[model samples]
Target chain A: MAALLETLTEDQRDALKELMNIAMGQAADRLARLIDTLVILSVPSIRLATECAPDLSDCPIFSAPSAYITRQSFLGALRGEVLVCFEQDGADELASLMGFDENLNTDEHDELMLDVTNILSSACIKGLAEQLELPASFGAPSILATNSTLFDKVGDVINRDQTLILEICFKVESHSFTCDLLVCVARESLPSVIEAINRMLEDL
Target chain B: MAPLSDLLRAVIDELNMGVMIVDPELRLELWNRFMAMHSCRTEEDVQGRVLFDVFPDLPEKWFRQKVRSVLELQTLAFTSWVQRPHVFDFAGSRPITGKQSKMYQDTTFFPILEHGNVTHVGILIADATERAVQHQIMHDLNQRLSQEKVEQQHLIEKLEEAQNQLLQSEKMAAIGQLAAGVAHEINNPIGYVYSNIGSLERSAQDLLDMVRAWREAVEASGAPELVEKLDDLAKKYDFDFIQEDLSDLIAESREGAERVKRIVQDLKDFSHVDKAEWQLADLHKGLDSTLNVVWNEVKYKAEVIKEYGNLPEVECIASQLNQVFMNLIVNAAHAIEERGTITIRTGCKGDEVFVSVSDTGCGIPEQNLTKLFEPFFTTKPVGKGTGLGLSLSYSIVQRHQGRIEVESEVGRGTTFTVWLPIRQPEKQVDE
Candidate 1:
């Protein structure tokens, strides 16, 4: 079967990018307020693929702590994964500054990560939804590990050829952050995306 | 007319809170008037509707989870927070609703049953607002207590850090109290190395001069006088012996260097077991290094006599025990102010290894021996002690599941004996 995307016309792609830019900017602003940090979200690289493993090389999680993050997933018309990852070193450095011990194991490390993630991801996800004119709520968060094989569960449906990955960086204060957003569909959902974004940007 | 159940239900409804009754499948059986007023939904509207369908706007995960557990796991679900709380919509009820001073207490979900199967779940909301506020206050108080404990621990660690610095300076202070002995210890090797270097340099210089002289003699007299002398000189100096001796000297120097390295390393390990915890530590190793730390204190006042026997690696916090050893050794030295011997004997007996440090100094008064292990009850003068040394030792030994025994006679001095179990408690090993 062909990808759900029938080659998007350049104009449609441009429109989607521009709309995403606006949505992400709004999300970044919301995150900045929550984490009390300056946030810079890159215009996410949107690709067309599904159900096959996506190349995770350029993933910022590799350069960051395997812990300390907040992620929210929305599963419906357009199923994808959204993440807010913070560097554990940054966390340790922050803890050091706060005069906390640096010997936190995976559990404490994750707990701190979740506390921040809860605030950051919730704010950003809600802001994006509000812009999209969707009155949806977020799910209770489950802390995740970036350095392990567990991350693949974020998009279990993602595969080599059909799944799409849309990742953005959400910075907190001076610390840089990244969110990996994976969108998967058996066929293209460009029209739904275009429609959703159009409504969101206009409403905002 | 069914006035009885209605009357009883009406009384229950008049009580504070919104209560709802749902069947096994979450079919809304009853929604009170309060729920109707608060939720803006009549009982007839939600009477047969599933909980999730009615509260679709609610957090799906939190709601679906409680619903799933109420059915599958057959357990009630509950949540509470101090501020900015989440409320479950009922016909006319809420959780912890009142003045800020009368915040809601704990809220709970109950699984109601009928006919031995869970047929109904009663979602009851109580105005625990008062209990909630009290609990928050208590929680805040507990946090303050724990924060104080952490502050105390931080101070203790800081004090320990300062103590470690003092001990390091003491080790390096070279107070020259026993400068002669230390000088001898260092000089014995330097002496040989210096002499060997001198002889080697002299021999090499002679050889060079002889070679030059031989070359000049051959050039001047066409004879080999200097050459013969050179050969004769080599034999007299036992060139073969010097050759063999030179190799041995180098080997000896290397060995001495290695010994010095081990001594320095042991000093480090003894001075501060950085982690201050347990490992595959040899009690004998700890004892030896501790002796080095207090060597200066023990050297002149009392001779350290070690009676080492076969001992296994006792699982224990090594640094803590090192502190114990220092305390006992220094005490023993102080006891023998009139110049006596401090004997340290270590051996394994069954599952216990006993280390006894006996001194010929003034022994403890018969009754005072009991107070020796109590923190801050030191026999040493005020400035000389923290009083925590023996208490700390006792606790460290106790943590290792070990015990300390003291034997004393006024004239014969005192012997502090420590018995450590071969297998330490797992929790102790963790520390």
Candidate 2:
């Protein structure tokens, strides 16, 4: 489980976290601008994918039975999937902030979730890809499943044996909306991602 | 031989979903058969045209941003049927359901990368009308089921309430029948005992007069032996004191028996077993009789005050009206924790006669005032009240083509006024 973290030097891990922090900040800024509100972005954390799966029960969002999950696949120099989780109440708040109806029908809610996931995931992934000098293309964000089944569905998508998970939290200040974005990349893709980061670092 | 490009074009044309490719300038470059069928435009006619120019209803700003995102990020973007019902304005194909006239669409925009930069974007649109309709049907069914559940719950509550009312009335009817029988049975024995005491009083008076006459005769005859013997007998028997106390005892007994007879009569009147169902009756007489029947319950708790006014005889079921009065008066008594006043007031206004029972007791709270007549709604402790008194009174008043109104102040007191029509309506008799 610690092999992924052990493989990366402390300097490489710090550099990756810093890069994600900036990318997520840009994403949060885009959302804040879109909704005309303050968005607080959390410091990105780099961890092994296996560590996150087993500890998902400790996350407040996944503990709920009605958490909404959205998954989008990105491909380029680095290729993996980005999974975003929103608690039911947080999703409702986000929908309301996006000028959706307070009483959103199921279809409307699903659309809202996908729309948000598309906007944030694309912006953040694009920012990270651009910073690393890696051209990444993302697929259309699609709703996975809600509730406890989310974990099983996510597990089916990513290879748990060799994946690095970059966890980021996006919070809309003064609102009851928070979303967790987990970027899972295979260990095989990590070398290329690490090479891109090292290249950017040496250039700096 | 057909070229491979031509074969690929034929395959694309045969697909069911609409497919189109738009360049960076937003000009349509390729239009498939499905797009041509839905847009009603041939490939040659729309090939060089701007996308929005062909469909002016397209959300210009949103579509521009979506395409720009795909071009800039070189990533696929999506628009669901929920966001925009349809992009191409195609008619629904379902002839049977035909629930939606406009086709519901889920559209996708994918970047067609050339070398390293995207040159054109491919738009794929899938008809989602059937799925949308199915989802709507399911949502409607769920809403209807929830509404039906609510209505069913209300019906169950109503059935329970009706059952409670039936039980209360049955209990009251049984009590009423028993009271009528007991009053009748007691009336007989009290009547004879009263008559017997009257006769015995007269006989004792007559005997005493004869004894005095005999004594006078003895005195006139100057018979010393007989006078001495009579004096001795009088001293032994204390005859004079016996004669004095005997008449008083008989008179007291007669008074007591009279009281018993009056109580029986009052009980019979309260039950009104022999009275006609609907007749012209004095409200004051009903109030007095009901008060007498419940006097024991109120005497120690409150003082009774009657402020009578000239009232016309109201046509009603007197027994039921008396029951209402009994319920209200006893409720007033129960309300008062200590000595208070229960004012019985009566008056006539136009064609209506009003009787009110007012009490200087703990008043009903404002929140509970509206629910006062609801069955099983009570402030009294459990087992102390059946909570059906006011509800039954309200029903009884309604049956008489009348209304019961109440006014209360929290710390002051409560007044319950019942209004009865001077003449019972003919329609009420059928009810």
Candidate 3:
């Protein structure tokens, strides 16, 4: 309902935005360390959508001709999902930046992408939960789609209304490589997240 | 009811799944009846002992990380049997029918929180052996189905190719029948034309002789006026040239008619529509007829040479043998690039008659020599060949209890020699 959407006042929204930036910054640091390259992360933009279908269609990841999408689910206080979208050529760019000497076969390529997804999702979700004084447990990451632009693959997971969409872009400096990570908090977990954001706002 | 704690303890012990609790150091704090039954170690036996010390076969590194993740995050962590089966190394639930000796399990770890501090990790192990077995069976069935699908596709392609080849041979047989009918009709007309030309030649010669005799008598009669008049008329009409041209014209006409008769006879012999059964036949006559039958194909590409030796009559199906001969001769003609020689030789050794057709044309490659008789194998482009010529010839030769030998050198030439016995085997003769 619109009541749920307006629950996060301007000050709470600002606090949530600040928390997301700090969490994504930590994820970028971990990735940069792993690949031995400078990784630049954009300030995460947060939005609450009452309609599930329109939000995903408007996402830039689906605007791409094709992309490799990975999904990892987290449980406990921060129960939701994280989606990592690698552009059509993002896999090769990341592989090269990671100093893989030989061309990766299909399985190896999928494994590498999933590993990257795990590293990013675990780091970002854990960091965000810690900031909110909550615990987060991660499931195994899996490839959701390759060479597909259909939003249905991601839409089915975020079926409920009053969903929070957090979008961040990761870029490898000195390379044309870029990827998007979307953190979706399920409707059931929204109130706890909002309460945590309001608590942080009050403490400030 | 007893105290709530005691009631819960009883329920946990009687459950069908394995329940165990380990402290931060992985020291076992509790073990349920399900775990004790499978491991044969009661809670008292495993008390104060590390989980690995009790079960040495456990994957210590991976299990520790899974538990550590749950404890540090203070949340639940899980693993499916598909990801890692046999987490506990317990005996399988199904003793007799289960293929695996160890039970497949799906393990989950829950962090027990006290006052916002993690104290123990509760591990729950569920028996998934039946589901694992069913999944394996489904996987194996899927693999076999896909393999059979590939084999079915190949068989379909082979069947389609065989059908096409049969249709091609059927078309050739129909054409052969039509050619035989046409040859039979032409034979009658050719026969009369040949004989009529011979009779006309003789009649013309007789008339010329009579005129010559009369002229001689008149010249000898001593009538100067009559002789002078005859001489004048003969000179005016150029009678000498006419007499010479008349004999030449008759001879040429007879030769042409005779050639037509030979062509019709060649067509009849090539087809052998009337006498298709086994019989004693001269192979030399068959070879000559086959060569004439394919002469149009050869004339532009090659010259024909014959080296005939004495060949006793061979008992065989003449029509089938003619077909073999036609295939070989035509193949030889096609092998020639621009112009070459097709040498056909026939001879008899002991009771076997061998006929070889050699061509001085582009030779076959060494690799293709063995596959030459296999059906549907052709070097010729599509639509140019049905690839059944040599295969049909091979079968026909096999039916006659004969074999064809080939010798060739690349860029030089090829020779195909067919050897047949003078008589069919006694058993074959009876048939």
Candidate 4:
């Protein structure tokens, strides 16, 4: 697992984390403004995608059995999929904040999930693209599963070897909504991403 | 000569989708022909106006935030038809399905960047009503298919129940035929053996008396030697004890044969082969006969108690009613593990006669109460029950235009009460 992370130089790893921190901050800010609540974001962590497989007991999102997962794909200079996992308890608060009734049917829950995923994924991807000067387009966000195994739902999509994963966590201060965002970049896309980051570094 | 900018404007005007641009202050900078057709306003009227003012129904707060995010992050933003149905209320062009009364739209906001600073936010809207209608149709079809699947499952369950009831009745009919044949075959030999035992006892008494008289005559003829010899022979053969024991042996044998005859008779009565047609009969008599038939099964498990009521002669097929009594009594006996009482009570309620069989044993659970009469539903261990006893009993009562009711409690007891009218209705008989 360490060998996979060793593929990136110390400077590249620090740059990727810094870029993710800025992107996730923008996502948190947008969600806060939309819901009129304060949002807190954690420092993003960069690791090998295979190291994040759910079989690891320490994996945060997978360890929580009751998590709602949403997924979207991005295409541009760097490409892979983005996964947002929301705790089940947090989903209720999020739904209520969106002006939905306390008892949400399946369709209402699905709509709420898609709406949140769209807000966060778009903001995060857009933030990254703007910083890297890379034009990226995001596919429509969709709910993958509710109250199900996160690994089983996303295992096939993220199964490629030597993929890099960036994990970010966020919380709504006044509400109970907390979630984890995982951005997985294809191994082939890493070199292009590194070049873009170095170009921005020289410009800075 | 026309400038290249004028030709670009001409091409934008010919496009099908709506186009608009908003500046940093959220004022509309440009509107295109598609927007003019849908919004009922042209570029001359809406340009330089606030976008919300032009379309009052637009979600002002949400749209402002979207445009702000585009300008602030310099990143593209999107909203699907599902998130918000339409930003502009364009009337429906195809109203056949009436699913969409207004045009469904997918919108995107992109920042127009110049010199690394956002200058304007350009908005594009595409009609999505056709796709929305197709999705609605598919969702409706899926819901209907699931409903049909549920109904089909219920129908299959009902068919299975009917088949089980048919099978149980067929099994009972075959058993009844076999019982009747065996009873008839056993009756003949038992009849003659019972008669011969009675006659043998009387004939033995007469022969013993004749032998004693002849011995007295020989002794009185003064043949002393001959008399002594005869006395020795009688003592050696034990003639006196044989004369005394022979009569008792014949009497006991006669009694045993009588019991065998009675058991065969009870079997015949239970099968009702001799009388199938409906007739007026005493319920108590039928109850006693059923008790005799099932005594061996009940004797060791539980004691039987009878509570008789002044019941009228019910018009029913006696043999079928006997069968019902046998099933209930046997079920009650099976319910009692040991040292419990099976109470068989009968009484009259207006024009109806009721029989109740109750057991002081483990009672049924509340969840299983409703399923008690369903075919193939049993709590007994495998092979201990066929799970068709109660179901068959239920159908038999229904056939006679009667009803059976039960009350039970866990670890306390269970009671099955059957009610039948004294007179069968003519319509019921025809059916």
Candidate 5:
């Protein structure tokens, strides 16, 4: 990300970072309302990178096997897609939270896990829409790979350093949530995004 | 009131729905021919009267507001059980199809807006009697389908269980065959050993007889010397009764071994590995053997009072019925913890033979009585009850085209009456 940072002008980086700071706060507020909790948000730190390239193993949403990996492409000047995960331990916790006995049958457990993912992902998208000031609507997020299937397909494609990710943390009602906001550009949308931010800054 | 209008009025009157139209002041304007038939009120007296005065029993404020909302919104359609619970009984379609021609229980209230605003209201009431009956039929069909599906699943499970039992029985049969052969071989040796023991006893007896003869001969010829010698011999070895008891001890040991052989045969026959399907069986025979097996439990705890009446041979799955008997007998024993009585009576009732087992023990509580036939429900303490005894018996009896009923009072006793047809009745769920 530091090496990627050198590609962008100083003004562009500052604008992007400031934009991220506002976006993360908006995301947190949306979550706080729905769950009915006073959620405190930390401003996201923006970094210019071609890809998030997060440690695949660190993503608790996927098992080492049969995990579906999907990539969503949002079309616009400066568009980024989020990575949502489904993990086994997370499923166990989620099923318990849904008031299901831990000894639920396999299909019941699967349904509970599906509901949890749906709620979290939809909530996060609502937050993103609030921040971008863009008329944000979502298409269905597809499952890309199951288990470690993404690791092999994404092996060398994620090395780009020009992409930037704004990562934010939300603390609400004893639940800690981490939302990743990625802003990817094709060198063209980067300018538009910057201009939008400038117009925002001028208004501010 | 022309002839054409009269014809239309007659047609409307014959229709099933109750249609009533009211004017601006909420006075009934068109209490149609249909309303006259259902509400048992004619248009003449009901017209020009307030709806409240007509149907005074209608529930309160919110309902009036809902009517106003209908007039305000111009439409409303939803089932409302809130007004009263037995809503279905009030003559409305259960599941309406927007058709009010039939005797259905669905109701709809409509607002007639003349100028994009409410002017009058029409209430359409349809008799839901047929719809309710249809709904019940569909519901019963659904329940039967669900029950059949469950029974199908259980049948599959039962098949698997029976297959496993068959395999277990096969293994035991093989062991029994081997045991029968081995026992045959062992018997040959036993017979020889037994005969040899008998011969040895006889030889010992002969040596004793010879010794006795010599002693007697000596005593007769004798005099004081011989008599003194006989007395010394008697004192040296007290051989008084050894000759009389040795043979009896040897004979008893042989008889004990024969008893063991009979028990092994009974067990092998009980498993019945060679045959799988049910056969006609004598209930008395099955009951006697089952009683013998459970005797120890019942002997000290409860004296079994058996009154076996004349009964025809019953066609059934004998082993399963035996299992039912075993459960009931053991249950009776358990009920009578210390010295009580279990009275078992069998009699023919119509085309069925009824067996009733009554125990004078701690009876079931009324609260737990209904659930006694429910699977996995038990009043017995944990580890002491499987909760399957009565339920299993119930299933078995049902499978036999039979029914099981229990009557009991707390602290009094429990009596289980099972009725079985003389012939196999048509298959129910078990098939």
Candidate 6:
């Protein structure tokens, strides 16, 4: 696992980061359109590993005391899953943003979170797949954990080895709304992604 | 043999689930046998028609969005009966028992790709009525179980309260019986001792008078030798001291006997455990008897003052009222830190009589006043009080259709007043 990152040359890593930034930028735009607010998306970070566990010390979401996490899987030529991490009060923030403060019960809050997860994951995966020129399809997004930042849940959901993790952060301007999106590419499909990255590098 | 295409077509028609294909505009391109059998629309009847047009009950807006997403993302989309009970309102699969009138459906939408571009969407529907019914039954059972759990907890609390009350009352009854028995036994011995003292006092007075008269006669006779001898005997016998102390000794003995008799009478009146029925009784007598019964508890800590007023006979269980009075007096005595005063005041207004016991002891805090009558609520140290004293008193007063009111100021002292009607209502008199 430690040597997994050494396999990617500096050029390949940079190329992957650039692609992720574009993909995450598209996802942030979709969210902005959905909530009718400006969204700030940071530059995406890329990490590759041969096991499910990845060192998450530098990641703000994983290091936080607690978080609300949801997961969505995409299948076909591009296969992996995305984990959308929100702060503890993320439901209130999103509910206020969408003007759903009236009668937003617990079940409704979970539904809203899953809906947002679906939108963000599908949009982000679609963008990434478009750039790589591969077909991707999505499974339904579900709540993996709520008000918790336990890595065990993340590890259980992303059990495949030889994984590539793409990380990005989203912030709503002038609001306390922020979330992190961690996209994990599956083991069997890592070679295709690497091959695509190499092809992009050669073009560059 | 039939061609492979013909055989496949027949196989698709014979499948159990409802299978349909629709174009991008939701125009039905294919409908299977199950769809035709449920909707009562043959393929020829609904061919090339918009799906929503044939089935107006369908959630058109949501279905449209689901199909659009599946087409746009080229991904398989699904819905469970739990989330959406039915995509199409078909009759339930169970016809014999008729437990369900509406079918539950778990539907799925997937894109049909040709040459890598999506052209149509396929829909599959499966009957989920049995699973939905089972889940509903389980949920209802769980709700009832929790409700029973809560009721059981409440019943257990009630049983514990009743048991505690029985224990306290039983212990009190036994003590009352013992005190009455001891008072009865002491009454016999004290009665004889009192009469004997009365007879002795009269006899001694008569003898002394007679002796004095004789001595005067002897002196008049003027016998010098005899006079000298009498004087020597008197001096030797200390006759002056004997004459002075005899009356004093007799008086003290009478007073002691009277006190013992009064105490025995008070004990008999205070218990009345044998006569537990309600009667028209004097509250003053009950109060005095209760005071005497608890005097030992009060002597060291408090000085008691009785401020009595004329009151009508109150209809009540006399023994229970005495118990209440005893509890109040003892509690008043216990409240005093050093030496203080406990005052008993009685009065009448209208048809009600009131007796208030006031103490000059450290008063109860304002916050504790409300919970004073609650069972097991006490400020006294463990074993010093069962905390049932005031609660029992309150209930006894309530049983006579009376109420107890309390007033207190911290460090100033507290007063508890009980008020009862002069006569119980007619219905209670029957009981």
Which candidate leads the pack in TM-score? Answer: 4
Candidate 6: residue A46 Cα off by (Å): 8.5
Ranking by lDDT: 2, 6, 3, 4, 1, 5
**Model 3 clashes, total count:** 0
lDDT of 5 by residue, B1-431 (tens): 11238777677667766666766456887766666655667788887988778777553332354355345434432222211222122333334653333343445566686666778776766554665656658989999999999999999977764555455445545764675566566666666776776787678778888988988888788688888888788767766656556667766765755544444444433444444356877888778767865677789998888999999998887766776787798998898767899999999988999888999999988888778876667767899976666777787788788999899987789999889998885564246
Instruction: List the lowest-lDDT window of 10 residues for candidate 2 chain A.
Output: A57-66
Clashing pairs in 2: none
Across B63-133, the per-residue lDDT of candidate 2 in tens digits comes to 77667667765667898786677777888868576868889998989888768788889999999998899
* Predicted structure 2: clash tally: 0
Off by over 4 Å in 5: A1-204, B1-237, B243-262, B274-277, B280-282, B310-314, B347-355, B422-431
The estimated TM-scores of all candidates read 0.33, 0.71, 0.65, 0.76, 0.42, 0.64
> Which wins on TM-score, candidate 1 or candidate 4?
4
Point out the higher-scoring one by TM-score: 3 or 4: 4
Best by DockQ: 2
Per-residue alpha-carbon lDDT of model 1 for B237-355, expressed as tens digits? 78667755755775666567656545655556664524455665788888887887778888999888999999998777676678778889998998887799999999999999989
**Residue B251's lDDT in candidate 5:** 69
Q: Write the per-residue lDDT of candidate 6 for residues B1-431, one digit (tens) a residue.
A: 11238777788799888999998899998888999999889999998999999999885755776676567656566666765676797999998875888889878788888887779998998888988989989999999999999999988966875677678778878888898899999999999999999998998888777767767877999998878887887789887777778899999999999999999988888778877899989999999988888889999999899999999888999989998999999999999999999999999999999999999999999899999998899999999998888988987898898999999988999999999999999887786
Supply DockQ values for each candidate. Answer: 0.01, 0.24, 0.14, 0.24, 0.02, 0.15
List where candidate 2 sits over 4 angstroms from the true fold.
A1-114, A123-167, A171-204, B1-4, B39-49, B86-99, B177-185, B208-248, B266-287, B307-324, B346-355, B373-375, B386-388, B391-404, B418-431
DockQ of candidate model 4: 0.24
Alpha carbon lDDT of residue B255, candidate 1? 68
All models: lDDT? 0.61, 0.81, 0.80, 0.78, 0.59, 0.80
Model 2 per-residue lDDT tens digits across residues A49-148: 5556565555443344547778888887778888888776536777655556678777767877886788677777877777777778767777777764
User: How well docked is model 2, in DockQ terms?
Assistant: 0.24
Local distance difference test, candidate 3: 0.80
